[model samples]
Target: MEREKIKRIVSKHRHEKAAILAILHEIQEEDKQLETESLNYIAQLLKIPVANVYGLATFYSAFSLGKKGDTKIRVCSGISCHINGADEVNEALKSKFNLEMGETTWDEKFSLEKVHCLGLCSIGPNVAFNLVTYPKLNKERIETIIEILHKRTGDSK
Candidate 1:
């Protein structure tokens, strides 16, 4: 989770002595893909090119250059979810997070990402955080989730 630690981890594999792609792959696996900070740190620690890291990160959507959220809220915008009030669900989430699509909440507790499908069209209007899915969601339910999230974060910190 820390840059210096990532650098140190990557340092265990020397570029001249190790496989470049293997190092990048390993870094990506450990950090859920190349975060820009991790990428730069990895490059700096190993004396590799930043562009190489950037190139690899960009080459794969599995990579991310920025920070991810503690809770990733993915709302399916696929056709089935669309007809079943995905728009309303999307709006409610946006309003609740005070964010548009593809944005993370200011507190960094939640990030809203839209996907084409969640593979559950039969359960349309799907909303999920990590792995917990809520089907047939409404505004009221959305509000409840927000409240619960606030409380949970409050208690943890």
Candidate 2:
């Protein structure tokens, strides 16, 4: 993103409490991820330590240190989901997307992650595709979802 835009974002919150958090949020909203140069600029402008800025970016799961895929898939690995074949679901996703956990596809179309729980134990093997949750997943169900996700992204695969 343009430095002027980032400067404007930081300038907006410079006098506010917990301005760093707000600045980070704005940057993420605009860029979809936080760049190191932007973080440094923010730190320099705020007169705070660069480590502090970087630390906040890393500490929060909401923050992405680098560019992320268009679609983010978070498979639930809670005890209930685990017992109900979450592992199998994860494997299916990995195989389909050619990605391991905490990795994004080379096309930047999809990213995979393992999260603790979706708070719906009864629906074991839950998966969060973007913001929506899919429950009671199996290999077949996962396949259908994958097709839909791919279609949405205009990927023939």
Candidate 3:
């Protein structure tokens, strides 16, 4: 199943000399992370060294080499966010999800991480849930958002 997906992605970008990043991004988007077997298959299909694929995967912060949860949550800890109560927002998320920075929930429903900034300093205390930034938040708003997400997924937890 996975092999066929990789083939399609590679075939889609077959003519490009620097399709490695695009291919990797597409794979990551599908699988939530880059697996070793997938990387090897990509290298073989692309006729490039596995090391080359691995290097790019490891170098990019956007790529997750390990498994990630269905939802990714990033809290901004930049100076502006800090002043605007990002710490409290982060703590609330930790309390609600039972996860620390760079940790995923046991259910694999959510991954919590900390980022320096999202460039929304004016509306500090920004949090990115699944890459969508929500600015000017407090503990209550974040918790409510989490609950809404959980309800949407039909997860009573």
Number of the top lDDT candidate: 3
Q: How far is candidate 1 from the true structure (C-alpha RMSD, Å)?
A: 4.4
List pairs with backbone clashes in candidate 2: none
RMSD of each: 4.4, 2.1, 2.0
Task: List the candidates' TM-scores in order.
Answer: 0.71, 0.86, 0.87
lDDT by residue (19-67, candidate 1, tens digit) is 5567666665555435677777767776778888788777765455554
Candidate 3, residue 140: how far the Cα is off, in Å:
2.2
Tens digit of per-residue lDDT, candidate 3, span 1-157: 2999989988999736498889888998889889999988988998889999899999987788877788888889999999988889999999888777887777777888888788899998999988688888999999899889988865623
The candidate that achieves the highest TM-score relative to the unseen native structure: 3
Alpha-carbon local distance difference test for all models: 0.72, 0.84, 0.85
Which scores greater on lDDT, model 1 or model 3?
3
Pick the winner on TM-score between candidates 1 and 2.
Answer: 2
For candidate 3, the lDDT comes to: 0.85
